[model samples]
Target: MWCFDNQKLHMNMAILETQSEGGNIRDSLLLTCQSSSNLIFGIQPKQEPLIRSLSESELRQMPKERFNQNEFSSIKLSKDLKIRKEDIILYNRESGILRDSLEKDELLTKSEKERRKTNREKFKRALRVERLHFLLPKKEKNLKPQPALKIDWSKSKIKTNPDIIKVLKSFYTNRRDPQFPTGNQKLLLEKLAPFPIFSVENNLRQIILAYPPETYMKNLSDKLYDYYYRLYEWESDTRATSIGFFFFNPEDALMYESTIWKYGSLSAAELGTRLSFFRFSTAYKLNRTSPPEIRFLFIPDVKEVGDLVTRYRYQYGKQMKFHPNQKITRDGFADQPIYTIENVQLKQGLFSRREVSYFGELKDHKYIFFTVDGAESAWNKFRQANPNLRLPRRPNLLVYNFNSFINDCEMDPDLINQNFIFMLNREAYKALDKSKQDTPKVSDFSIFIDNRVKPQLFLIKIWAKRLKLVLFHAPRINEFPRREALLDGLTNFFPPSLYRVK
Candidate 1:
């Protein structure tokens, strides 16, 4: 084999010679030697051929030298070098280069050499930037910006239990319900099973309708709580739920979408605690006797609401059916189809948190195809009926336009098939995206769905950690009170003693 040994070359050969009876030249000669890397051969014993040393240029003509002359040159340097042409041809292989049918022994041009040099320079610059901007600073703690979130009452279009209404009024007004009045002086909220002031307009009939299903509102409250505890000091501040709430300043609204106002740090537990507060399949409680406070509060981004709703429908609407008798059920002859309880499965299933979210399976796809307007309306109704019983108000309200979503689905994967979060405005999401882009090296949450693990289960765990609300939608029915319902409900209701507020 051709190789550099002490920067020299050598060869081995066997030959048959007869002591001359008289001085006479032989008829032929036998040669043996290595051809190239990983090859060796000798002339056949019976086939004696003429052999002679080759000049440097002549040796360069050999096939082995045509590709890697530097390697084959080592062989030529040896006085002992020897080989048979047949064996050399048998071991020949191209040196990963092509030049028509015949091989050539030529060096690459200077331009090709320069191109490689340029690539190496680019690599060094990239390495330097990466070290300074990412690797070096990763160990340093990140600074958090001040927290800003919006909190307010929104119009509801579904039935609300009298007790929950009383609780909300008490919390909002900081006062108990009024004493009995002689006439119709804002009849006691307790007397109304469902309040009318919060009604919404149905896109189809344009009629003021009651709120969504009971469970829907309950899930909404769960989302609020999920968001509420995202603060770093929430647990220490509020021993009851360990969640903190911050309101957005009026001045901040104008610049809400800016990156300067969006980034902050709160413990992962804070978000998890909030998500654990709802009625996920059932409910889950944190194991600690005194859990950490949650960091909650962030501005809402309304522009993203449609995206959030589309995701909700994809996860829960696939198997639902609308019944005509139900409030959300549609009447004959319209551009949109209505959904109701009759044709849906009202089962309590885990949607996000460990606690189960209340959901129903629809029996028809026609209802879903009508549009997101109808889906939004039906979701409102769905929320009103299920009244998760544990949570206090409607889950976060998400309005969507189906036609717009389907048309734009190809542009954004999150808008079409994944779980989404709603912000009060567009700026919040923009700020988040910018922060992530600026620090491209950060690791993100991911899930692997396989035989032993489900993607939804991982999503639930992550949702809890982020203190984010989730909604699932599908072809037939839309799932409500997502991850918030599961994690928050379980965490809030767990260990019973924590329920006894200090």
Candidate 2:
């Protein structure tokens, strides 16, 4: 299936290959021991098609002889639109009239006029509020073009994990929270605008990788998969308590931990966390902290089956400048909307235990965001447009100690503690064993807190005796612990890359 959208490169391109010869992408897809893909095996062959939509006239006007990523460095309308003075005397009467007259009298070329008109329209809409909070989701953030890292299946491939396959077949059951907008507390509901989720046209599921390079998908993906298995859902725990569902496979808890230790390490998990934080820092647009419309799955277990194939159903509307590397999306995307589907079928293989997780709504997509000015009107339009589409009961995602994840009251800048309990890994158990010395009165072990600059090393306090790791300490280092006249600490490694402001 051709998954690339109407405009620019979409999704992780490498996971696919043109099947024009056989007329089947599945045949080209890796179908070896890996029953399914943790990450779609690889991208299609390099495509040379230019932005066929761009006119010869427009291409000539580009600043560089070639395309420029900064060409569309978003123009922030909110800043100029805000009104500060309580009294300006009709813009000082003369000043207002003179400014209006000068603007009306100025003559401009057709192209210039079109550009100005587009901006003016945005300005006019912003009149309803300060620069109409572009609240629209942003897809691209400026990133220097870098080549996509190529993956060769024959070299250093992840060995098949029979245990995980067995475990999923035996224990992984499908689960859903059926919750919606449950986590939208930071954002007020009255200000929200409900938009229908982006649909899969013609029932084809195309997974578009918007700006995959911007997040360094290759490097991130590299750290995710080991020689034996992939850490597809290492962050599953983070989402489990927030917006996502959690099912305790207690029957296989200890076994699962031991299995992971077979191939990966805690350091790998830390690197994964840093990469995630890096994505969080660089993935979103300036106006939004996170993507506004988060897709919280109704069926948690389905996603656990990260082994599904790729290619998605998508609607590409509007073109924007993107990364300027060698071959993909450099010239920009199509100006018109096109519905294209890149289908990668999920192979159920031998794990046909519907008794464990009978298929849920595997194709449904739900998305949401908030609007300040037209909340009522937006919902009214939504109600009239899609009467059949129902919203989940929860407004936003909810977390057990979600609030404690941050310092709302701004308490101790150094340490803000919360209630967290997790089973200690084998490393902690080993530390406990060491603490018990040869002395008969003492347990042979040592006590230590995993203060490694790890962004995801969740273990904060460890009780060697009970072998329980306590975590989630919101540390506010307004004054780094080693910042006084008496303490000038070692400098930050990546600095701020691992830290979150909120």
Best-performing candidate as measured by TM-score: 2
Give me the candidate number with maximum lDDT.
1
Residue 315 of model 1 has an lDDT of: 45
Model 1, stretches more than 4 Å misplaced? 1-242, 245-429, 442-502
* lDDT score, candidate 1: 0.26
Model 2, 1-502: lDDT tens digits are: 1211122223211112232333332111111111121222132333432221222243232211211233212222232443211211111112343444323325545665566566544333222111111111122235321211111112222222244663463334221221222333222222111211111101011111122121222243433331112122221121101121111111122222222222222222222211001111121111122221122211111211121111111111121111222122323222111111111123345764221111112223211111111122333454455445442211121111111221221233322222212222233233334333321342223212222223123333212211211122213433322122111232222211121111
The deviation in Å at residue 137 for candidate 2 is: 25
Q: Which runs in model 2 stand beyond 4 Å of their true positions?
A: 1-245, 252-259, 267-502
Q: Candidate 2 — worst ten consecutive residues by lDDT sum?
A: 195-204
Per-candidate TM vs. native? Answer: 0.14, 0.16
What is the lDDT for 258 in model 1?
19
